[model samples]
Target: MTSLPQQTDKKLGLVIDLDICVGCHACVVSCKEWNTGGYGAALSDQDPYGDHVSGSWLNRVHSYEAGEGANARVVHFPKSCLHCDDAPCVTVCPTGASYKRSEDGIVLVNEDRCIGCGLCAWACPYGAREMDVAEGVMKKCTLCVDRIYNDNIPEEDRVPACVRSCPANARHFGDLADPGSEVSLMVLARGGFDLMPEQGTKPVNKYLPPRERPAEPSSCGKRSASERESTADATGFFRWLDQALERMG
Candidate 1:
């Protein structure tokens, strides 16, 4: 089994704002495109136009409803490899294929060393690892490691593909190790939190909770009675896809 580094030099991660995320799925599509083409093995689709279709995807957003009445909301939860400091996936790798980088704290799989055993996926608490059925290896988010430090791309476009493609500007990437970093400050301001604190993974990525809905209508504008009564059900990322695919069938 593999072991984790005592510490990493920098904690590079993401901050997702749940309040503004429209559940558009721009991030998910962007991630699939970039990872398949730019970084690792291709993300293959099994029976894409047929039935029981499944394939590899590094990132996924699961939207679910929480709370009640005026306080209720459809939260868009984007999830991926958190690159936990005490990454269970890394420690459970018998072949030592899954490892965390000491420099940036990014958890990654060395495909050459991987045996296609699926142990890392089982060990992961976030369900972030994906099996490449075509290539017989595990794949995951690398935080666009190749793009972040590349001199070829424009400075403004160097962020992870998901962060770059989000139309609402809901995704942010930065060094979380620095207290003064923009991501850290955003966490402090928004009361960002871990996915499952009880797991003790210490995931680097933080999520800003969705703000509570106002009880009274906004004074600046008025809404039709029809709009007021309407509710958004499963309009979030993964659920939307599930509903769309079901309609096709």
Candidate 2:
């Protein structure tokens, strides 16, 4: 089995805002493109236009409607490998194929060393690991490790493809280990929470909850036309996501 690093020099990860995600799947597409292009393409599509269409992708989003009637709101939740501090997938690997990097705490799979074993997928609680049926190797988000460190790319484009391509700016990338980092401050201010924290994985990525909504209006009184318009404008997801993120401070 593989062993995890006792400590990493930097904990690089994502901070996602649930309030502004538009469920556009831009991150998903960008992740697929970058991972499959020049950066050691590992993804595969099983019958692109057939009945059972499936593809190996690192990022995905799920949407859910919370509450009902006037209190209801659609929340777009994005999911990916959280690169946990105590990554069970790494420890569960029979070979040393899966390991968490000591430099950045990024959990990654060395495809050459991998034996196409599904142990890592079973060990991951987040359902982040995907088995590439075509190649029989495990695939998951690597935090765009290649793009992040490449000097050839423009400095502003150093972030993960998903982060760079997000239209809503709902995704953020930085060193979460630094107390003063923008990502860390955002977490502190927004009360970012880990996904399935009880599992003890200590996921590096954090999610900000949807902002609190106004109190439900009384059924007895109908909303005035201007009041209704204001409410509708406020709740429009894509319309004001940029403004909201800016005001998020």
Candidate 3:
């Protein structure tokens, strides 16, 4: 078993907003595209065109139905390695392949040191780790370590690929240890939560709960039929005028 760092300088992690995630899978696709060739081993797709198709992906979106009847809503959950403070995946690695960095608390695997024993995957309760069938090694998200710290890329773009590519801007990345950081402040304001608190992993990543649905108006705010029609007419005229202006410009 490998020993984890007693303390890390920075608890770098992600904060996902459940309120605005549209389940577009943009983050998922972007993560796979960047990480497959960015760092570690290439993500392998087995029998891609066949019926038994499978591939190693670091990020995945899961859809769930919550509430009932009028309150029913489909929630899209994006999941990945939580980079737990007490990471079981790191401790269970017999060959010391899986390790969490003391500098940023990012969990990573050394492919050369990994024996493909699958112990790390089993140890991870969140099912974040996956085995690349072709490469015969366990693979997981590295938080885009290569891109985040790379001086070759622009300073403004120094974030995980998923965070950069998220169309809904639901994903956030920053130092969680800093309470003044944007990510930390958002977590505090939105009542962010962990995946499995009972497991005692103390995951660094936080998830913002879905915002409460606004109460529906009983009678459309008591708008008269003629007033509604007039509003619609004005809206249409403005929309048409805006399009004409764009074309002329």
Which TM-score value belongs to model 3?
0.86
Candidate 2 local lDDT, 1-249, one digit each (tens): 379888999999999999999999999999998998744446999998999999899999999999866778999999999999999999989989999999999999888888987989999999999988888889999999998999999999999999999999999999999999999999999999999989999999999999997677643235776665553345567558857776889
Between candidates 1 and 2, the lDDT winner: 2
Better of 2 and 3 by lDDT: 3
The segments of candidate 1 whose C-alpha lies over 4 angstroms from its true place after superposition are 216-249
> lDDT by residue for model 1 over 42-139, one digit each (tens)?
88889988978999998898999997654567888888888898899999888988899999998888888898999889988889998899999999
Per-model TM-score on C-alpha atoms: 0.85, 0.86, 0.86
Residues 53-87, candidate 3: write the lDDT tens digits: 89999999999999875567889999999999999
lDDT score at residue 96, model 3, on the 0-100 scale: 88
For lDDT, the strongest prediction is: 3
Ranking by TM-score: 3, 2, 1
Cα-lDDT of candidate 3:
0.92
- List candidate 3 segments past 4 Å from native: 216-249
Model 1 weakest lDDT span, ten residues long: 213-222
What TM-score should be assigned to candidate 2? 0.86
Q: After superposition, how far is residue 29 of candidate 2 from its true place, in Å?
A: 0.5
Name every residue pair that clashes in candidate 2: none
